[model samples]
Structures are given as structure tokens and as C-alpha cells.
Target: MYKLSIKKIIRLAAVTLITCSLFSCMSDKSEQSKSFSVQITDKPLTFCNPITLDFGTDRARRAGEAVVAIHQDDYYLFITGLRGYWYSGNMRDWTYVDAPDIPGGCPSVASDGERLIVSGDKSRRDVYASADPKSGVWEKVGYYDREYGDADMFIDDDGRYYMYWGWSQILPFQVVELDPDNGFKEKGKPVTLFFGDYKSHGFERRRPEDVIFSIFSYRDYLPEENPWIEGPWMVKHNGKYYLQYAAIGLELSTYSHGIYVADNPMGPFKYSPHNPLTFKTTGFMVGAGHGSTFHDKNGQLWTIVMIPSFYGGRGSGELALFPTAVDAEGVMHSNTEFGDYPQYYPGIKENAVANNFTGWMLLSNKKYVEVSSTLEGYGPEKAVDEYFLTHWCAATGDPGEYMKVDLGKICDIYAVQVNFDRHDAKLEMGRGFRMPPSLSQYQSYTVEVSGDNENWSMLIDKSNNTVDNRHDYTELAKPVKARYVKLTNVFTHDEGKFAVKDFRIFGNPDVAKFTKVKDIMVVRDPDDPCKAKLLWQPVDGADGYVVRYGIQPDKLYNDYLVYDDYTLDIHSLNRDQEYYFEVEAFDSGTDYFHEKTRQTMGIGAEIELFRDREMLARKMIVEGKNEYVFENIIPGTYQLRHTFGPNMWVGDLTKEQLIGSDNQVTLSEKISDLGVGTKVLGQLNIKVIPGKENGKFVVTLNYDKP
Candidate 1:
């Protein structure tokens, strides 16, 4: 009986031990799963079917340049160049609002959450305000004559309203404070922003004597002149104001648009180092200028500009909308194509507060670091600079995540560094982040800093690595006084888990001086034999040189010539005739242009014709839709030729077999030639299948000419 009782006790003990072990295993799995988790609820919002409004016939008298704005969920459009008319919509359709009883021929419009402000010329410069959209009543509260031209209004985050407009006929820009309650009144004296002479501003390019003075042609004293600044518009975002305006000059072919930026709405605005933010339709005779910018309901920013189909003619332009993104310097840049919406990565949400603070996410290492105050335990203390891993159960390999950090409080950062480590113990063959799949492997990493977490700046970027484990660093001169920092890995292999150790922010400040030019040289009409070679002294520290010369100082000159070498050869000139020339130097780091040198030259003789006809034939075959064959009877190593455009051709057919002794060869049928006059070569045609959420199109080009 004692032996049997001992056996029963032993059996019970074993069973209890087994149950406890099972429970421990289950709990461990649960904790691991939670650590490597992701939530898709934070994805960026997608918008489609943009609401478009036609004010009138494309060239109708009443149809003119228009500006669009969004308040709350309502879309308001202010069309000018007409007497005055407004339009309203709600993301779907637009309803025309009759012009208020105001007398503005070319009016500009803006909104400040409570009222819509329109400023333009009635009898003189005037400002009108309306609270309700349905009501057509507009009351004039302010007026300025000589101090304003084509005015625009902007309300900043601090509840301060500002108005930016052109000053005198010579000076093109001025800014003033506006009191919403008392209308937009002059808070202070108008500040003259940009002023320059007509020739320096590219106004009278061909004939200085035939200079045309319109509202668009004004003297802007700003440093750069690709497009002459006019028609000022302002928008404030994340504590910065962006001024988008029309730059009318012969350099940009007249009536083009560009952007400038300033910390405050008042004086001292700087043109974007990357100016001419957006290029209009190339040869469609489209003139893009006089635009306004606003944010949509989803917080996406868009710019509506007048891209008139009639350029160099006598008609108004149509209004087209383009998406824009702000950089670390608060400068705005538009995307390459129109109608292309900005894409948001998954696992990132707009206006999300982590630890009660709002910010945007920057992705890196297939993991996301939630760097916001809204996150639990996120504070000045107890904040761990570590990686937040995410699971890839639903997708192949490992998925990535993004987190936003507020940088308003932190300023003067020297360097930002990130360290990464793999998760698995044994190294796997395919283990890394991929950038766009076509490439073979991940090669580099880059770090960017931003003040508002919206506009990002590249602090350090490095590529071409041979080692599996390596450390990279980048030194920044401008110790970023930013609110956000993003680190990205440009690796495209198989996605796997990686670990980031810590982010180190240091303080180092070192600034560099801008370069200036000394002298320049130009060779006029070298090919025509009638032109002369012009020369000038080189500026110290200049990265490159630009030479501007033409037959007449004002019109039909060749495009500005850019060269890394000190000298330039201009091929546009008439023999025995004097031609004007100007040379400028550009600093590569800052992209600042030095003072220009002017000179004159005369053409003396003509040169021999050395046309690459064989190269031209190959270019033509590449550009034609149907397969082309070259047939001839010559057999003594004659050159095969192809022409893509009038002065452009492909040469040296030795790289690939052209044809047999019969001099006949058929081009590939699959090759797509975009026909003659198409500037875009080797473009990929993508057809979006209805209802498909994601797809990619890739195009490649090969050169057979040697």
C-alpha cells in the first residue's frame, strides 16, 4: 500500500511540471510578437479626382488667370485678369460665384480661416473682404495706389496677417502687415524687395530699345535672374513662409514662375538656390506664371498657377495645379509631372501625436523609431535612442516603419549619426533593405535633418561599399537648428530585420565664404567663321563658368553656355558685325553667381562642314516607329548613319553590326520610337489597370553607337 501511494504522488508531480513549462513557452512567444509589431492605421491619406473648374472659354474675355485656396473642407477659387469673379467647390464640383462689386482687373485672393481677402486694382489698389461664400457683398477696408501691384495675402501661425505686392514700376515687391479686423492696412512702411535694370533682368534680350513694360516686367534687385520676379504670393507652413511668384524675362522665354523663401513675411527674402522650381510644358506654347499655393483637407500642399496655352500671343492662360514639397531650408519644389499626387509610405500618419507631440516619420533599417512626445514615456528624460522593430508576418521578409520627432526645441546640432546591426546570429546571403528592386544590392545610407519634420535636409550621404560591416560619417557645416532628423539606408537585397543602436547629435559650427568672379572670355560664332573668340580673367574659387552672348544684346542670342573650364566658345554671331557678350562664374557649393563681365566681338570667317551623316541615319532609325533599313551599293567600309533630330545624331556604327555587304538591316520591331520632335527619349508607357492599388513601370535604354 505504501509503494502504490508513492507512485501516485510521483505521477502528479510530473504532470504539474509539464503544464508549467507549456505556459512559460506561450508567454515568451506573446512578448516577442508584441515587440516586433506594426499598425497600418497610420498610413498616409490618398487623394484622387481633383476638382477642376473652367471659368469660361480658354480665351474668352472674362476668362483670366485664377488662384485656388482651401479653408476647412471648402475649395475657393479667385479668378483675376477679369473684372472679378469667384468659384466655390467641395472636392467634387465647382459653382461659379459672381464677381463682387469691386473694381479689380487683375485681383489676387487668399483666406485666413474667417474671411476671404481679395487685393487688386479697381480704380486704384484696393483690398476687399467677405465672410460668407454665398454672399457676393465685398466691403473695401483698405487702399494703396503707388505702393502696391498685384497683391497677395498670407496669414501666419501667430495670427499675424501679411500682404506681399509689387512696389513701383522699377521695384517689383513689397510686404505689409494686415489687421483682419480693420482690413489689410499698412502696419509699417512698404519695403522694396527686388530692383534691377531691364538688360540685367533679361527683359530686353534681343532689342533693348524695344523694351516692353507690362505689369510683369519690373526691376527686382534680388541676386538671381533666370526668371524676373513679379506677381508675389505667400504661404506660411510650420513656422516658415514661402513666396511663389511669376518671373517674366527673355532668359526663361518670358512669363515663367519661380519661388523664394523667408523666415518672416516681411523683408529680406532669398531666391531658392534651386530656383525655377517647376518647368512648364516645353513646346506646347504654355506660359506658367502668376500662381498661388494652399493646402488640401488631407494636409497636402498644391500650387495653382496660370499655364496659359497661349504664349507670346494675345490670350490669357489656363489654371493648372501641381503638388509641391518643402525642403530643409523652407524652399518649395514641385514634382516633375503634373497630376502626379504625392505618395505616403505605409505605417506613417499625418498629424499624429506620439507622446502628446505631433511630427512626421522618416524610415530606415526596416524599423521605425517613434520619436514623438505622444509615445508613452517619451520625455527629455527616460527617452531611449534605440530602434523600434516591426514584424513582417503579412508581407515577404521584414517590413519597415516610420516615426516623427519634434525638433523645435533642439537647435544647433553638429552631426547626426545612426548605427545598424543585423538580428540573426549567422549571416544570411540575402539580408538588407532594398531601394527600388532593379538594383542588385544595397550600397549606401543618408541622413537628413528638418526643422518642422516636413522639410528635410541632407546632412550626410555615402555610397559604394565593399565590406558587409562598416561605419560612415558626414560632417555638416550648418549645425542644424532643426526639430527632426531622418536616417535612411539605400539597400536593396532581401528585406530582413536590422537593429539600430543610438543616434548621436553633436555641436560644431563652421561657415564658408561665397566666391566672386574676376574676368571671362567668349568665342563668338566659331562655327560660322564670322564670329570671334572672346576671353576674360577667371574668378577665384569658381566651380564653373557661364557665358551669355548673342547677335543682338537683347534677342536671338544662344542659350547661356555653362562650362567647368574657364573659357567658352560662342557659335552665334554675324561676320564683320559687332556682337555683345557677358560672362559669369558660379560657386558649386553655394551656387552663387559672381559679378558678370561684358564685352564685344566680331565674326571673321566660316568653317568647313563636318556633318556626321552616318550617325544621323542611326539616330533616325532609333527615333522612327517602324523598323528602318539602310540600303546601298557601296562596300568599302562606308559609315552607317541615323539622325534623331536636326543637329543631333548617333555616330560610329562599329559598336554593333549595321547590315551585310548588301547594306541592308532591319531594326527591331519591338523598339518604340516616339516619332520626330519628341524631346523625351526612351519613355516607358504605363497603363493603370482600374482598381489596382500598386504597380511599377520600368524602362531601359541601350546605346549601340560607338
Candidate 2:
């Protein structure tokens, strides 16, 4: 019989301290598959769902217009999230520069060839300057008399300082001359540069919760005619000036940004026909606006923008980076099309961003997995589904817990990104977590691959790694062919339960042909507010269908694969918001599911997102006495189900041993697992001799779905 050391289970238990406080904390495309110009990175950039901007101690999720500045020709990324600055020599690795005096949110900092000027959104336009911004050394230099809106300080080539600011629908993104010596005080009257045209420019219009009315009608405080035109940032490319600015309310999924160009830094700016260059129309994480553009060490142009998060603070939560380029015609274009996906960065001195793509599709996504332990919602699939928010945690906090996958075929493997899910707060609170030693980590692992299912080779060894890169991407210097890959835990960083979100394996399969999906459309179900219908023009020669959907187009966390139908009901979505989905028609049917392509990933089964909200079932052993008492079940009809099997032993329990059941319970034969999705609930106490060997069990309870 199983017993609880802690008699009172912590239901709705607060997420561990890590989840609350650790709010803290990409790619190459190329080749003849090179038909696609975008490149993938060794480290595919995933979405910042629960962004990693949580400061050292203040776990608040808030930030203003993100700023990317080059101080004295050095690349720096600064955000007012908790009012701290991050410095980077190579745009990839960043180090935090301590600046405890900087106020939170809506702060702007800029360099004037020699000095870095900093200002905030407070009533008084007090400014601070630093000769050495790299080290966070600043002293209040001067003050301006007027209280300004969200603004950007600019210094033209000829020692002239200017300020551009405004966000009122009636006002324009105004520009004014400033006196550099006196905190960039206004020297001339502000002139209207551009205005919001909500009527003509649909992106600038404020959406009234009417799109998904039923789900978002609770936003009753929305004011009409409140379109915004603010956050002015300027860039000088070639002989022309590009005036960039953000618009619309932050609440809209379509909140975006656009630009205007002119020959001189000041007058007659022409709006680019390609306005609203940066936007995120659909996804779990929406809106990318109010950002700045700058050059990296390589002089490669990059834009940093604000991305809204359901879990973030006011205005928005996290910042996303998108590489920008000026076309032959000199139109500056910010490539945010695949903004949330993994992207390759510009090399230290390449003329442009070189996408280094290893032609390998996701090889281990949704395939069968075997782990040392799993319980309740922390199922094994959580590690494969690519949802970092969920996880597969070991039942006990023990070392040597491992998860393995059988690829069915010996394939060429190149790279793997190991995303260890930090923590899953049973209780939603906040975050501040330092990885404890008891709940240590895999100090080292003898990552092995095998072809005969018996013989193995050490692919990569981390058996004594002192540094814990919780999210690690190991790009193999040489590709290896293997059918099975196993991550053996040699050690752990802590003594707590071990968990992981996904192990994204990259490798090529045998030759295959895949027909691209055409006319794929996602629309809300006419009869259901919570469901969306994805209809597509079926390809003539196709194996099956695969659909990936997420709030952010870059991170489609939810996926589905259908072998027989052209339609799918997306049952998992927040009614109040829109979602982004991309569909594909594959040539290999479910029979060849093991051979997944870049556009198509295996859809074994996506545990219902709602399941996480429901009461989880207890897991029992294959052969042993099992007693499970779900207290306060609240008197409801329930069904018994299993993860691996409703094994023969289940029938032996008999009627008396089954708790909370009155009628005779019949035992049914089970053939496959993952076929029985949800709506199965129950409580039982059974005993079986140690003879059965083909079953694994983890059960969950929930009300029947309509």
C-alpha cells in the first residue's frame, strides 16, 4: 500500500519559489532546401512565453519601449523592465550592467557620439548622462522644462540634437530641435511628422473586443477613438533618414509599427508604402511594437521590439529581436515574419546575416518516450510537445532519472536543443528561484545513441559538467547515424524532482517528397466561441495533414495531425484572444509518422490544455497493491483509465475494491496507449502479483466534456 509522508496534500500548491521569482530567464536557413532564404540557428530561438526578464529580486513583468543603443560604438541592449541595462560585445552573449538608480518603465537612453543621455517618463524631464555607459556610470547632467511623452533623443551628424515624441490620436509623432547642452531642451516648436490614420490604416485602429466578442467582452473599459501614434525612433541609412514609430493600443493583437523616410534628418518625410513593417497578427503572444533599430558590431541592422504576454506586466512583458535590412531601393525592412522562430544571427563581419542551416527536421518530436518516472500532469509527452510551460518531472527527486526515445530508423543526427523546464508551479503566484543543490542537475550525462537497440556509442558526454546550462543546444561537429537516443542522467544540480520541456533533435531522414499545403485557413467555429476550424485545400497526393498553432506565429505550441480529414477543431484556445496556425500536407501517412519533415511533425497526442486545469489522477505500479483515495472528489460520476493499460490486473480488483462505485465494473481489453485521450476518471485500490510486465499507468480525473 502507498502512503503519504505529508498527510495533507498541497492542492493548488503554490508553484515552487523558482516559478514565482525566476521570471528570469537562434538559427540558419540555407541550402537547396535553401529554396527558403531564412536560415535556422544552432539554437532555435523559442518564444519568451513566461519571459526571462524577471530581475534579480523584483519579479515584476513590466517594460517600456525597448532600446538598442551603440554607445561609443559598442552594442548594448537596455530595458526598463526593472530598470537595468545589459551589455553585449557580440549581440548574442549579454552581461547585466548594474544601474540600481534607473527608474522603472518608459525610460529612454541614447548616445551623442560622446555621452549617453538617459531620461524617463516622469513629470519632470530630468536627464542623466554618462561618459562611460558601458560601466553604468552616470550623473545628472541637465534638465528640460517640459514633461514629454514617450520619446527618443537623436543627435544628427552635425552636432544637432532633436527629440521626437507623442502618442495622442489627435497629435502626430512630433519632432523638435533641442539644445544639447541643457538636457536636450526644446529649442524650437514641435512639428507634426506623421499621424495615426485608424480609418485608412487598419493596423492603427483600436480593436473593440468585437473580433472574439464572447471571450473578450470583459474589457468594458476600452475607450473609443483612442488610436495612438507614438514612440518615435529614427535611423540614418545611406543618405536618407528612416523615421520609425509605433501605433495603436497595446491590448490589440494587431498593435504594430511603421516608418517614414526623408533625405534630411528633419523635413518632408515620405511614408514607406510598406508601412506597418513590424506586426504580429495572431498567436498566443501577440503585438510587437514600440521598439528601436540599431546596428550590431558587424553593422548588421537589428530591431528590438515589445512583445505582449498574458503573464506580463503593464504595457507588455518581454522583448523580441528581429534582424532588419535595407533593400536595394533603400527601404529599411525589419524581418519579423518568422520573428518568434529560431533565426541565425549576423556573423561578426558578414556583409549580411548568413543563415547557417543544417538540413534536419525535428526527429524526436511526439515519438514514443520512456522515462524513469512520471506522475499526474507531469506526463512524458510534456517533454516532446514543445510547451515549456508544461513538463515531465520525475516522481522522486533522484539522480540518474532519464528519458529515452526510439527513432524507429537509423537516421543522420546533427543537433539537439535540450530545454529543461525549470519548474511547474502547482500554484500560480510569482517567481524567484535559484537552482538549489539538493534539487541539483545532471552534472554529466553519457548521451548515447544505438542502432541495434542493444549496442550504443557515447554521442556526447557531460558526466562532470560543472556549469548547468538548463537550456542547452549541442550541435554535433560531425553527424552520426542512430536509431535510438538516450540521455542518461549522470548527475543533477539539485535533489528535487527532475523535469524537461523538450529535447528538439535535428537530423535528416531518408529521401522523401512532401507537397506544400495550399489555401490553409483558420476561422472561428460559427456555433462555438471557444473552438476554431482549420480548413484547407487538400493536396492531390498527400500522406496526411499536420497543423501547428500558437499565440505567437513563431512559437506554435499546440499541434495536431489528421490522416483522414481536411478539417480539425482546435478545441484548445483562449476565447478572448486570436491564435496563429500553419498547416501542412505531408506525403507520408500515419504509417510513416516516424519520418516527419520540417513542415510536418508527429502528432501522437496533445494532452488537452484544459487537462492542466483539472484535477490530476494518481499513478500506480504495474504489479503491486495500489490504493488511491482522491479526497473531496465532490460526488460526481467518474471513469477509470490508464496511461499504458487497463491491464488484466485491473479486472482482478473486483467490485468491492473499487472505491465510490455501486455497479459491477467490467474490465475491457486495451490495445494501444495515447488513443484514449481524456474524460476518464476514477478511484481504485487494487493488488496484482508481480507477473504482468507490459503496462504503465498514470490516471487523471475530470468532468465529461461536451
Off by over 4 Å in 2: 1-64, 167-171, 204-230, 247-255, 281-287, 309-316, 337-341, 348-360, 364-408, 418-503, 509-706
Question: What is the alpha-carbon lDDT of model 2 when measured against the actual structure?
Answer: 0.53
* Every candidate's lDDT: 0.39, 0.53
Clash number by candidate, in order:
46, 49
Q: lDDT tens digits, residues 477-505, model 2?
A: 77898878887666544344566666656
User: Which ten-residue region of model 2 has the weakest summed lDDT?
Assistant: 13-22
**Tens digits of lDDT, candidate 1, 1-706:** 0000001010000000000111111111110111212222321222111112332212122223456676545676666544344443332234545554655555667776777777776356677777864456777766653445666777777788777776233566777776666545567667766652333223212232212222244663343432245667787766666777675532232344566677777858765544445443221123345667666554545555654322111223344444554533344554322121112211122211111011111112111234212222222111122211111111111222222333324455644434333333133322112112233333245567787657787776644433232112222444456656664545423343333333333331222222324454444443454435656676765534444343343321122323335554432233434555555553322222221121012111111112242321232222112122232222123332122223212222231233333323322222233322434334312111111221111122332321
The parts of candidate 1 lying over 4 Å away from their true place are: 1-59, 83-92, 145-147, 167-169, 180-183, 196-228, 249-254, 311-314, 336-706
Q: What is the Cα root-mean-square deviation between model 2 and the actual structure?
A: 13.7
> Candidate 1: lDDT of 27?
17
Cα RMSD of all models vs. native, in order, equals 26.9, 13.7
